[model samples]
Target: NTTPTAVADAGDATEKGGVANGSGGVVASGNVLTNDTDPDAGDTKTVTAIKFGATSGTLGSALAGTYGSLVLNASGAYSYAVNETNAAVQALRLSTNTLSEVFSYTMRDTAGATATANLTVTIHGANDAPVLAVQTTTQNATVGSAFSFVVPTTTFTDVDSGETLAYAATAADGTALPAWLSFNATTRTFSGTPTAGGTYGVKVTATDLGGLAANETFNIAVSVPGNTTPTAVADAGDATEKGGVANGSGGAVASGNVLTNDTDPDSGDTKTVTAVVFGATSGTLGSALAGTYGSLVLNASGAYSYAVNETNAAVQALRLSTNTLSEVFSYTMRDTAGATATANLTVTIHGANDAP
Candidate 1:
């Protein structure tokens, strides 16, 4: 008998003519085949394995040839044969534990046979738990001034297993954070007081159950104190006249000195008046005579004015004296201008000495 054996080249398969003797027939098996073309003459034929179906499959002995009952491994050992007259095509699924199955094979013949290839699979787990984000109210702050900030209460969660995470803050400025800040592990809330002010770059680190960690840093700016001017009050005794002299004659004049004018307590504006007297006097003598003066005469209105009386006998006698024989008297007029006024005076007598 003469038959055709299937051979696969790359993915395509072709049927090659096969020769046989009257009594002996050709058989294809395994990945390679050996056969006798002429039994009497000892001629031989060889066939290469063919690929079939969706993958690779074994060739069964149901299609007998000259070689006594050929055996094919179910573990994808041989190529597949085409269905000469097919009502419906069937495919073969490659199994494990075989080298032939390890090599991927595509379908070359759909009607005859089909096969399915095996594939290795892998799945990665979810990323480590998500880290909580750090929160802050301000980056810079003033010393002695208070700053308020809040840390979220929600803990980080892993996409795969969903577990709470832990966190801590590190002061990169080489100082410790104040204790006024509070922390709650259950709520994952963090609150703290920062007493010191400066450029503090702080880092907050968060860790999860899977040993994964994340960190964030923040900068703070602190300001110094503000400027303030001193207040001054002028002292009474410390104040001097426009000439830089203290409160005295060459400085401030006496409050009641008729000879000197007084000045304003602050502005130094002087209050002045001409010389004038306010008083009365009396006298008597055989020759010329003089008398001492008395207190000033003030009008009913309290205003001052000069007053002298010559109506008295003593005063008339003093005026009548003409001989060289004489009497002398002097008087001091006391100022009666009161505490608030100054008094000035000049005096002249109109009496003469008598001569015998």
Candidate 2:
């Protein structure tokens, strides 16, 4: 057997061999196998490995038995054993599934040569589900407000390696969650805007691919602040209509207070008042405002008007105008929230006894 000799930095040097994840095996040899023959005789000498040993560097301590440490015998076969559930095993598995080591060997020829190379092994580990514990038992959120809280990873722990976790939130009592609150299962987070105020019972569950699961319950209380109902401004009765001399020009006129009486429950809320009705429910007041003798007209503020005498010239000349004009109407008050209140209005116009 023809053995190739190794040349170190200054010439003679040694190599160190290491265990491959305790599986017990030589990953690489210091020299490559080769064949040489005497020119005239045509005799060939091939590579023959003679010695294998740990020239330097100590193997890691064996966890249980000889898991992490490596063992190489003279024949070149190596061996090792590791517990699947060992913490070191889990750490190595999590870090890229590989362990680094070095080993040395000598060839079987006249010049024994040795070199060292890296040995790496991919480690297999058991998978497991994450375990969870509740860090917060109660939470508070403002009503009608958006909220988000990240579930801390420290709250959960996993014994087995290589696990990704998922989270889900539900009502402990099995009641459907309010439309406001929502959960992000992928991020293992809880988030949502609360619409109403109330004490809600909820449970958060964490699960892993290994089908391991844990749950924790907490009360989420939504605080509801006192709300005020809109104020419907009371209108002081309209001005008293003065009694005129039968059908005379000085007849008293009246109008409902439109803008002055409108109000909102919230001080900052917008409110609007509109005269929903101009005259009686059964009849149209006239073609337009003030068209009929007693036609009623509405202002932007909800104030209304009626003409005492809309009769023709001849009727006025004969003093035969409407003696009394009466009108009934409705007004609607609205707030920013679309809430509405309606009111009725009645007004009678007195005349001096001639009919138009």
Error of 1 at 261 (Å): 62
C-alpha positional error of residue 63 in candidate 2 after TM-score superposition, expressed in Å: 9.4
Candidate 1's displacement at residue 215, Å, is 0.6
List ranges where model 2 is wrong by over 4 Å. 1-85, 91-124, 159-161, 226-356
Q: By summed lDDT, which 10 consecutive residues of candidate 2 come out lowest?
A: 9-18
Count of backbone collisions within predicted model 2: 16
Best by TM-score: 2
Model 1 scores a TM of 0.28
Q: Write the per-residue lDDT of candidate 1 for residues 26-81, one digit (tens) a residue.
A: 22223322211222233233322323223233344332221112234433344333
Alpha-carbon runs more than 4 Å astray in model 1: 1-112, 117-122, 126-146, 152-163, 173-190, 222-356
lDDT of 1 at 62: 33
